[model samples]
Target: MTEEPARRRYDSLRRTAQAQQTSADIARAARTLFVAKGWAATTVRDVAREAGVSVPTIYAAYGNKNGLTWALTDAADLSADLSRLLAELESAPEPPRQLAAMVAYDRRLFERAGEVIVLLREAGRTEPELAQAYREARARADDAHRQVLSTWPPGALRSSIDLQTALDIYAAICNIDVYTELISERGWSSEQVEKWWCTMVIRELLEIPTAAT
Candidate 1:
């Protein structure tokens, strides 16, 4: 009886491993399709064909194209990277320094997030599921900012800038779309853009004097 139970357990572990491998393959294929055809134009069948698997296999592994895309998003490490940055913000010694660190982190995130950004923009037009995921991610980031603000020392600084304004400025400075538009589209250098934006945000929203300028 014990041997039978052990065999069953081993079989279950093997099946779970196979399923995870299939899901990973599907996600990789979906990312390729997304990049080649854009998220709106890519279909589950396209991903299945690209992956050299049956459509049912893709669906069974990922539930749907959106699920596959979500998996791809996870693979990209965007959320994990952002979460780490947020944690860094929480641990930084001072608010102004934390804000500077946050801006720098945003720049790094944008550099690494080009493909995910493209997918997100495409999703905004035709994929409700992706758009919803994007919004939820933004909301989580916003919540993190709010929690950070809650630790601010009570004073005129806290009184002058409400949490909402601080969150909005943080969101604007951290927004990849805005960064792309200003830096990539407008030909502003990353350093120039971040410094200027960070200065303005710190001054206006947080009433914090930038150390150097």
Candidate 2:
């Protein structure tokens, strides 16, 4: 009985590892296809072919193409992953520094998944499922931003700025369109963008001069 239980544990661990690897492979393949072909044109068959898994596996792991899109979104979800950083933001002594750190953290996330996010925004225009997913993703980030904002002691924010405006500024500057504008189209380097992001987030949102300028 002891031997059988040990064997079962090993089998379970192996299956878990294999499942994680399979999901990673699928996500990687889907990301490539999405970037190359755009979300609207990329189909499950293409992903299955790219990932070398069956369509059923894709569906099983992530219900459909839109489901796959959300899986991608979840993988890149900034709110889901910030532990130490979030705590750091909460503990920061001033609002400007906290906002700067938050922007820097979110900048790294956008750097990783900005292309897919842009694709989803384009797809969202015509596809209802993707549109909903996109909105929910934004909501989650907004909620996180709000939580961080709430950590500020009273009067840390400018008297003129309200909760909603602060959240809006955070969302707009950190979103894909601005990223695409500065980093994608205008040819700003990642360093330039991150610097600008931190500065602008501090100035416009927190109403403070960035330390550099």
* Local distance difference test, each candidate: 0.64, 0.70
- Tens-digit per-residue lDDT, 53-111, candidate 1: 89998778778877775655543444225445544554463667667766766676576
lDDT of 2 by residue, 1-213 (tens): 354443442343244334445587677778788778877788999999998999999999989887887655644543223543544553454677777777776777778777667767778898888788788878867766776677567766667889899898778787777877888789998778878888777777654455632
Scored by TM-score, the top model is: 2
Residue pairs with backbone overlap in model 2 = none
Candidate 1 wrongly placed segments (more than 4 Å):
1-32, 40-64, 72-80, 83-87, 156-158
Pairs clashing within candidate 1: none
Please report, as a residue range, the 10-residue window in candidate 2 with the lowest summed lDDT: 8-17
Score residue 157 of candidate 2 by CA lDDT. Answer: 68
Q: What is the TM-score of each candidate against the true structure?
A: 0.66, 0.69
How high a TM-score does candidate 1 get? 0.66
